[model samples]
Target chain A: MIGRFVARRAAMLVATALVASVAVYGALFIAPGDPATLLIGGGKPPSPQLLAEIHRQYHLDDPFLQGYLRWLGGMLHGDAGQSLTYKDSVTHLVTERIGNTAFLVAYAAVLIIVPGVTLGTVAALRGGFGDTLVTVVTTALMAVPTFVMSVVLIWWLSVQWDWLPAYGAGEGFTGRLEHLTLPALALATAWLAYVAQVTRSAVRAELASEHVETAWARGVPERFVVRKHVLRNAAGPLFSVSGVAVAGLIAGCSIVEQAFGINGIGALLVQSAAKQDLAVVQALALITVVVFVVVNTLVDVVTAALDHRVSLEGTA
Target chain B: MTGSPPLLVVDDLRVDLPTRDGMRRVIHRADLTVPAGTAVALVGESGSGKSMTARAVLRLLPSRARTTGSVRFDGSEVTTLGAAGLRRLRAHDVAMVFQDPRAHINPVRTVGDFLTEALITTRGVRPRAAEAKVTALLREVGIADASRRMRQRPPELSGGLLQRVMITAALAGEPRLLIADEPTTALDVTTQAEVMAIIDEARAERGLAMLFITHDLALAAAVCDRIAVMYAGGVVEELPARHLHERAAHPYTRALLASRPDPAATAEPLRAVPGRPLSAFETGPGCAFAPRCAHAQDLCHTERPSLSPAGEGLAACHFPAADARVTPQPGARSTPHGR
Candidate 1:
């Protein structure tokens, strides 16, 4: 059952990636700008013959379908074309910045998942004062935008206290962690609140379910009731919502990355888009789409595995 | 079993729950007992506090629920027992089978895990030994291929099978008293009979005391040694199961017996007790059932009746039926009670 589910998901992943690639490629292709002239002519009024030659050389003169197919074929063969803005291979540009974004997102994921789920579960179990406090705090946190949070953290933690770097991706693991901390925190604040709220509601619902009551009636300890009955049942919904939170985190990273002046794919995407760097933008958008699809698919598989009522046979 | 000292004695047990309105007395000074190796059925309609009385026995009421009366289980005071004491009591002495087996059993867990969890966790039984015991218990409850069934989760099992599995899980602790709160209510009629039979056999074989809660008075009469009829959160009559139809002293018991549909009486419309069932909050100062009672007098409406001995058992009624002779109806079926 699990094997078939994974196979189906893999096919879905490939199809989703192809569709996303087409959309991103088409959007960038038809967008109002000429990347070849922008790069080769450098905003000057170059000779008409020279501009024509540049367009031909760069395959800009090719028909839309032909150009897109050629790009897709090159992508299949490990080539992502050259970035007109950076004057480098799109793959190299993305690879260099991809690590920084991955680090930032991974760091934010830990921040969001750990404390978010913990506080939420605690709030649900303890209720009353603890529950009220968590609800109030998470609500307040969610109201603060990511960029606003970034600015505040930069001002408070970096400018005022001078505790860490305010901008840029630092070298080495420790330095990167130190530099990434504020941006990740800024990026994660909203998601952490969201995940906690979801977890709190899910866990609360599970706590009220008959299975938890049965466990309590059976003389299972309160802790075991929460662990085996409540948490296990709540995990499916938590995992599912966390997938959406992860995609949100990735989307929000562009703003956070720009705020921190970090050379991550998020920052690269924003800068390249502004410059109309179609190859770089298309590549980054395709990667983001793939990641979102893959994460959501994994969440579905894991949720089905955890909950017996959720069938892998498409009945669900 | 009747001569022996009761395994559980609940004396004037009152449970008040805080609701949106106010503190509503859900169980109104209920008095009942379950003797060793016997089944005592607490029969009532919904909201009649039969389940509340059962929950009170285990100190398992909701957090806002406050109980003001005494419950003694196996010589230990249940209401006063601390958390650890209550845990030990529930773990070693009492087990409960809820109404819906599918809802009560955790869906993510396998049948084996659900059955053996309490044994391994609370009793300190070895996992292998617990598994063996669970397998045997499942078989004893009439489930076939118990070992293979153990690996499957609750959703994989039919309602009847899951209910049997629930019973097997309950008996895994070898509890001295089993509290079955409408254990067979969620099953079909045939499955209900089969499950009840399994419970009856288990009780006889283990000498387990049982407090059975149900709305079906006939089923109660069939399985239990004694029946306690509840109305508006209070038990109005207590009598031997055999005498429930013939010697019932309380008017409410008579009404309940009359309301039960008989297949042979299809020529006549079924008799139903008049008036809506009252919540605890809706009861007045007098008898809660007075509004619906055909025999209710002005005294029954103004003053409550305390339980007193009437004929073979206790009943709370302004005028006990013992003083009046009750002849069996002419067309009444000769069979004892249940279909």
Candidate 2:
């Protein structure tokens, strides 16, 4: 059953790749601007020899299908093509940006998971005043947009207090962390709210399940009941949500990257789009789509692991 | 095992749930005493609140639910104990095997991990020691190839196997009182019997006092030493297992006994009580069962009944039934009450 699911998933991924390649090929045809002239500018509009040389060099002079095939073939060979904006290999540009985004996501994920889950659990355990307080705080945080939160955080922490860097990707890991901290926290603000809410609801639902009642009847400690029984059993839905949230984080990071002036994938896509670079824009769009699909697939696998009721075949 | 002191003493216990309007009583002043190592059954219908009464004794009631009166487990006032004390007591003195073991067992965990985690967490046993104990427990519960099955998830096992594993996990703490709440409800008849045998074996081996809650009076009769019949929010009857089928005094008990199918009397239609028990808050000033009782009198409606000795058993009834048995037919194979 697992093998069948894996095979079907791999097939779906291949289909996605095919569709994405076709879309990218179509995009070049539909785009109004001519890349050859755009590259050289209107200063005597580069001689036909120079234009032909540029087209031939980049494989742009070939028929659209042939050119698309060449690009797709390069992808198969682990090449993401060259970026028209930066005049550098797309792979190098994407890799550096991806690393920075990954670090931000990792640190922010820890920030949200550790505190958000703990607060949720404590709220569940201490039901009356504590729960109400958490609900209020998380609700307020949830209502605020991430970008708006970023601006507020920056003004207070960087502009007003001058504690951290206000803009630009920092130097090393420590420097990058300092630069990414504000935006990550702003991004995490919404996620923390979501995680807290999911955690609270899931824990409460599990606590109400017959099995938890059985555990209580057996004299399982309230703490153990909440920790071992409730959390683990309630984890199925939360695990799936967390997986989807990771995908969302990647999408949201683009905006956060702009707000924080981090030279990440989001910034790259914006730069490529502003320059009307069809190849780079299409590549970035397809990469985002692939990320979403892969994350959703991982969510299915995680949920299946947590609960026997979910069949992997059913997901396929 | 036979001569041990009473393990749980529940006296005048009342569990109530709070709603928007007011408190709606569930278990009403239920008093039950189970001798150590004895099996006591709390038999009731789906909403009769038998489960609620059991939950209150352990302080496991939901936040909105409250309990009045005392629950003394092994001479400790369970309600009065602090959180830490309750945890200690739960870990060392009591354990529960639940209904629908398939859903109760954590699906992601291996049987070995589930049992070992319980052992280490509750008993504070080291991992190595816990593993050996878990292996023995798995064997005792009749799981063949214990080592191999130990690493398998709950879904990989049959319903009977899962129940056995739950039983084993319950036993890991060596609890003095074992609470099995309709533990075989989800199993097939054959598997049910096997599960019962496993439970009985474990009970005898450990001399654990069991509170077996079920709606199946026949199954309860088969396993329990004593039976308590709960109706509405109160226990309507309590009697020895032998006396229940023969001399059940409460009208509710008699109706329940009559409802059981009789294979011998093929000509007679299966009899069931005509109306359901009134809602907990809907009970009249008198007997809670008066609404459904054929023998209810004016006094039964006007005055509430308490647990008093009626004929050979303790029951809450204004008018106890004279004959608990069904009028026997000539070709009767099994007793009218035996299913």
Candidate 3:
């Protein structure tokens, strides 16, 4: 069953990636203005012969569909073509910045999931004042946009207190961590609220389930009941919600990256888009789509495995 | 049965639950005793407080419920037991089998894990030893291939098989008092009899006392030695199971017995007691069953009757049916009422 599910998901991933590549490629065609004009000189009108040569070099003179097909063929062979603005291979540019974005996302995920799930569990178990406080605080936090949070955090920590750097990806391991802290926090704020709300409802529902009641009736200790029954059963729903949170975090990172001046793929995408770097934009958009699809598929598989009632075959 | 000390003694147990309106009394002055190595069934309709009375024995009422009473198990005061004391009492002395086996057993966990969890966690038994004991108990409950079933989850098993597994888990603790709360309600008729037989055999082999709760008086009579009939949250009649049909001293018990549909007597339709069973909020200062009782009089509405000795057991009726002068009303014969 597991092997079949994995095979099916692999097929789905490839199909989705192909479709995403086509859609991203189409965006470049529909976008106004010519990349060759921006590449040669932004405002100056170059000689006609020089412009024609530049268009030929970048394959801009070919039909849009033909150019896209050629790009797709090259991508299938592990080549993403060259960036118009960076004057480097698209793969090389993405690979260089992907690690920074990954680190930032991983840091934010840990910060959001750990405390969010823990406090949510605590709030569910100890309901009166603690539950009310968590609900009120998380609701307020969810209302604040991520970019607004970034600006407020930057002003408070950097401009007012001079505690951490407001912008730039710092050097070395410790320095990089110190630099990512502010950006990660800004990105995690909204996600933390989402994860906590989901966790709270799931834990509360599990606690009231008849199985937990049976555990208590069997004289099992309170701690064991929570660990073995409540948390284990609640894990399936939590995984599903966390998958959505991860996708949202990826999208939110671009805005946060621009705010903090971190040279991650998000920052790269913003810069390339402004410069009309079609090759880089198409590559990054496809990567984002692929990541979202893969994460969602993994979450569904794990949820089905954890909950016996959910059939993987039925989903397929 | 009369000479031995009772295994469980519940006296004047009253449970009041706080609702949106006010504090509503659910169980009022309920008294019962299950002697060592015997079975007692608390029989009643739904909302009659049979399950609540059983849950009160374990102090497992909902958070908003307030209970005031004495529940004694083997000379220990269950009502006053501390958290550690209650835990020890629950682990070593008593265990409960619920109605729906599927709903009660954790779905993600295997049958073996569900059965041996209490033994390993509460009794400090080794895992290997607990596994062996669980397998043996499963066999004792008539489940085949115990080892294979242990590895499978609850959803893979039938309702009857899961119920038998629930019994095994309950008996795994070697409890002195087994509270089976409508354990067969969710099963089919054949499975019900099989489950009840398994419970009876296990109880007899271990010499355990049981408090069985059910709405079917006939099923209760077949398995239990004594029957305690509950009405409007109070024990209206207590008698030997054999005496329930012929020598019943309470009008409600007589009405209940008459309501059962006997296969042999198809000439007459099943009789159901008149009027809806009163809820906790609906009962008054008078006898709660007065509105539905055929023998109800002006005095029956003025004063509430308390349980008093009639013949071999107790009945709480002003005009006890055991009196030779009072014959059953002619029209009160087998007429079906609402369930």
lDDT of 2 at A206: 80
Question: Can you list each candidate's DockQ?
Answer: 0.75, 0.43, 0.79
Lowest summed lDDT across 10 adjacent residues in model 1 chain A is found at A307-316
Badly placed stretches (over 4 Å) of model 1 are A41-43, A312-316, B1-4, B323-326, B329-339
Q: Is candidate 1 or candidate 2 better by TM-score?
A: 1
Give one digit per residue, the lDDT tens place, for model 2 in A84-169: 66788887888878888888777777778788888887787678998999999999998999889989999999999999887887
Per-residue accuracy of model 2 over B1-339 as CA lDDT, tens digit each: 246447898888887798888888877768888888899999999888887877676677877787888888877789889877887777778787778887777666678877787667666789889988889888877876999988887878899988988888888888888888788898998899999999998899878899999999998999999999988878888999987766787888989989989999999999989787665677878899887888888888888888887656688887776553444423223212200
Model 1 Cα lDDT, one tens digit per residue, A238-258: 999888888888888899999
How good is model 2 by TM-score? Answer: 0.87
Q: Grade the docking of candidate 1.
A: medium
Between candidates 2 and 3, the one scoring higher on TM-score is 3
Against the true structure, whose TM-score is highest?
1
The TM-score values for the models, in the order shown, are 0.96, 0.87, 0.94
Top-DockQ structure, candidate number: 3
True contacts kept of each: 0.75, 0.45, 0.76
Q: What's the lDDT for residue A171 in model 3?
A: 78
